[model samples]
Target: MRIYLYLIAGITSALIGWNIGQFFLTDLGLFSSFPELILYPCIAISLAIGMVLNEIFISSPTRPKLCLKKAKFPVLIALGLGLIIGLFSGAIAQILFLPFFGIPAVIVRIVGWLLIGVAVGLAEGLTWRWETVEAGDKKRFLHRLIASIGGAMGASFLAAILFEVVRVFLQEMPKNLRLAEDPIGFSVLGLFLGLTFSLTSSPSYLVALRAGSGFEYVSQIFAQISPESINLSKDYPRIDQSVLTFVSDSSLDRIEEGLSIKLPSKGSFKIGSNNDCHIYIPSLPDHVATIEIKSREAILIPHVLYFNHIAINGEDLKTKKNIVLKHNYLVTFYSILKGENNSENTIIINHEKIFRFVYYNRFFDPQG
Candidate 1:
């Protein structure tokens, strides 16, 4: 299978979905008349792209050849995946946008359901579902997960580049806090964005890969690679059973020293405590975690590129660690995983609000 061809197909699918979605938005007068209204269609289209591309990969053996006969399956798969992607993404989007926009929640729910078709379609196109893998695959889940991480990192970097280019062209920066004008609303928005991204991108693919055939390899590797990412989230901490120990800034004074049991709120969760965000964020599994964060002031800092993980070029984890303490650094739990590249279980921290972190050229200070 030609990787580049797959990429091309993915891009083409996105464009097609976007155009179709754009029409829907235009007709509803959503962009201007009710900006929130368009979110579902726009995102559904994006998912449609993913679903279609994934479908193409599926059913095509030995380097996908140009055959229209086989193309229909992906479209069908896309329709199915799009239904899911659209509803879930749209629901998340609505939760986030409604409070800020003051639109009714029911409306957003309806919107989400409406776009499920597109979402299902996009998932088919974009996801790395194994059914789509070409013949003669050699790599196990571990390798595929690694490849996914690499791909996701690349895609994220490209997105950063594109966003920057667009920002420069428009003479403006992305919005961070106005969305915060309604914290509850913004939180919902973040959830939607996270769901959208998870469904439509590398996170989904990576999770699938890790969960598939090589689940053992994926699980073992994560177990061997931690202690650094222990408490990235207040509510959700990274868990690797193979490794008993955990890292945290806050002492585990509140819980019984040896007591480990089920969590009441979410069925079950391991208890560990920490104040430091750096170790937690990077330490957590790379494939499936949620990051609850927002930009501080929305300023584009120079020399700061957010890749698979955020890093200052030439600086080591040590420096990034220091940067975390001095400035809260908008920390949150993120599930980083090896990418067999087709799991849709990622949780994203979106539109994070970090008001205290200040930047000084190549350096950062937690104090705003």
Candidate 2:
């Protein structure tokens, strides 16, 4: 099953890679937008690269029998073999295509060669030590299919995020001074460039493997975290006066709806639900109202400031005057009072563990 899975991934990704290479070759002179041309290549390449690297580079790093049984270092063997084939094939393609595409011929053919190496590596992993299934099904075809898809998807997301970060940083470079190219914030170009270069990495395969393995749930959680962090509903609402935000079930009507997630790549990371959004208010005004989590036990997540008071079940809960929410390796919960410009914010009874407060800060004011 696993072997069959690997076979399918290799075949599909290679086809995608080939078509993309051809598209770039023929369309170099066309005026069409870049997004249409670039996305496929990036996705295909990233998917294939991730698949290949996982097989050749990471094959026997964990297994013990391979260390003593054959004594042949796998990485060196694979590298030597892959390098030879990659060079020969790359040279042939470039030598032929350069006449038609000119300088771009060299570039596209080199990319094609990389994609070919990916295909070869993926195919080898499927046929050789991959076992297709377990001792019984390890070498089987179905399981391989599931695993291959999972690996590819996971790698894709990581690739996308890494690309996004790089794109944002590069756009700010002083060298990109084409004021006429883009009159706006220059964000679109950053996204495009980042996604393009990132595809060469093939993160989807790596991600797909995780999706099929023990880390599937973790991947799902992280994928959801990125988007939920940007949801508009999570944004701090504009208020005419003091506003209390409670995410608990009873505090809101739609607390349990419309938050399904799809990874567009793997199963373990397929459809899921996640709605924990972190809120950040940089400069709270003096006239602003109090901010509270209002849970029975607030697991004071990291990044909290000025926790001066505490309240519990009832009575003057002998709360401490500290902001450290980490108590004995645990995220402790508590009620708190944070001082603002002239007044202080307070918390009441709750079942949860910890609460946090950001006080109205003005320490540099030497005026007593």
Candidate 3:
């Protein structure tokens, strides 16, 4: 379903680009003749539109945070290469139209347009490659570049077909109404060109990325926090014969006394009393016993990247004491707690058994 949508978008964008290209040909002459004047704004607008669309559809769950930051250098390099190539192609076309070459002006102009389109497409494709390729695969630069160029050429051919159709339509319109003369009208036309190119280019780029090493790298990045990880933590709160319960309903309370219990293969848990005993009762006296629970036993593994902590119920019991049993022998309780060094931290427990861990950045929210 998503693939079809992307294809549709690509086709639509190509049509739009063709229309815009036709307008530029009619109003400003060959894109090669005014490469900087014509191509620069078009590139800027198209890239801006592409970035917005990428953020909306592609970034979440797949691309990492600060994707735009990572893409800056790549985008710059691609755009520079495109502009240089476009200008050079245009210059060549102009030379071919001279008396020495004896090439028809119209033919030269048409060829120039094709070259510019191909250059821009290739550059745009290269930009996508940087975002999709894995850091480890940077050595395979030539292979990725060749693949991007091929995809760009295909996209440009599609755009050319659309441009011819738009040109015919514009020719049918009244001469005065067909072209924009004022600044406001030109701005609108530029925006239209940008949106059209973005729609077409993004879909094509995504398809190319999927077909090459791009998809592999994107999958690798997302696999770190995939559904498997979430599922592993989902079945954390089950109970059996033995339960390890906290003394206070709030995990923020300082626990001075520790308790020891021979938890069955399946473990159990409950909240203990606030009094000196600080233990969950109603179980066999022989099986459950209270001892001095040290602060270090209740460990907080801070996820610095996410600003949350995975509070292990008794990590020390498994690691230090080497306690073992059946069924993995490890009873894990996942909780999201918000705190900093020597601060009043609180854990938000939801009824759905899902933990919402929030950490307040002291620099951002001092009161938190």
Candidate 4:
């Protein structure tokens, strides 16, 4: 269901961007005098910008602080790969339509877009770190290559059919408009290619944080947290106000419908008192805990001075080792001397602040 939403959002944004670009280039005649050198870069950059925009608005919202930093690399990769792929695709199309080969122009055009789609997919795929075992690097490359080729080729064929339909429709119109060329086909091609890349590259598990007990007015879910230090303190400086703002819910409503903050797909996040931690809880000491998440599982490693201060699901983390996180696993960080569990199973920290968390795992099967 979420994947469907992602595809819808990605394709819609691509079509909008493509149409705006088309209006400028075709209708307004902007950059009409530019040579191939300038035009190719413009097209390539446009596609890159679209891709980055989709990721920033959609993917980065899951962890908003890292959005700016995430944009730089994917844009560069897409720009370089788009240019190289365009040249390669153009050369292939030219050869296919040559007198010797005698292939139809339409056939060659489809093939060209097919190749471009594959390259686009590969370019997006390369931006993420794929976790695998046994010949990981080679396997990852081949996986991206094959997935992109298949997905992109399918999209290109679909676009070709749609292009012909629109062409026929325009030819029959009262205005006698003719389909001179495909101005919008590439955009459709880009839309599906982006969707393909997202489907293949999305993480297996999504981790989110709900404001548990310590928070007063914060009942919303935080969808993204900074990878380095996630300060839970309401007064923490440097925190993005947008990230923390959400409609407050009643206590019962919060338990049923509260929003949560999503951590990055892979990172070591610190939860501490000061700004140095990845997550800061105002009442907790410096560096109280660290959450190391990778692939499908998250582990809670305590760093507090007292073992009794923190517990998972009412079990004290006495082994002093990493504890695997589970869904609805309550992790309470409180002062042993002053805190006590209430009727609702929530801990009241130091009689004033209560730092309690209920973990929820998304998309992955429950682990014992």
- Which candidate has the highest lDDT of all? 4
**Model 1 per-residue lDDT at 306:** 28
Model 3 stretches astray by more than 4 angstroms: 1-65, 99-102, 132-135, 138-144, 180-368
Query: What is the descending TM-score order?
Result: 4, 3, 1, 2
lDDT of 3 by residue, 120-145 (tens): 44555455444542212343344544
Number of the candidate with higher TM-score, 1 or 4: 4
- The backbone clash count of each candidate, in order, is 57, 48, 8, 16
Residue-by-residue lDDT tens digits, candidate 1, 39-143: 444444454545344434433333455424445655555565554555465557556565678876544444443344334423442333333222112343344
Each candidate's TM vs. the true structure?
0.31, 0.24, 0.37, 0.49
* Residue-level lDDT tens digits of model 2 in 242-312: 12122111133221112111111211110111122222221222111222222211132222232222322
Number of the candidate with higher lDDT, 1 or 3: 3
Of 2 and 3, which scores higher on lDDT? 3
Model 2 segments more than 4 A misplaced:
1-77, 101-120, 127-368
Q: Distance (Å) between predicted and true CA of 107, model 2?
A: 7.0
Provide the lowest-lDDT 10-residue window in model 2. 207-216
Q: Per-residue lDDT for 308 in model 1?
A: 25
lDDT of 2: 0.31
Q: What lDDT is reached at residue 180 by model 1?
A: 26
Q: Kindly report which residue stretches of model 1 are placed more than 4 angstroms away from their true locations once superposed.
A: 1-7, 28-73, 98-165, 172-368
Ranking by lDDT: 4, 3, 1, 2
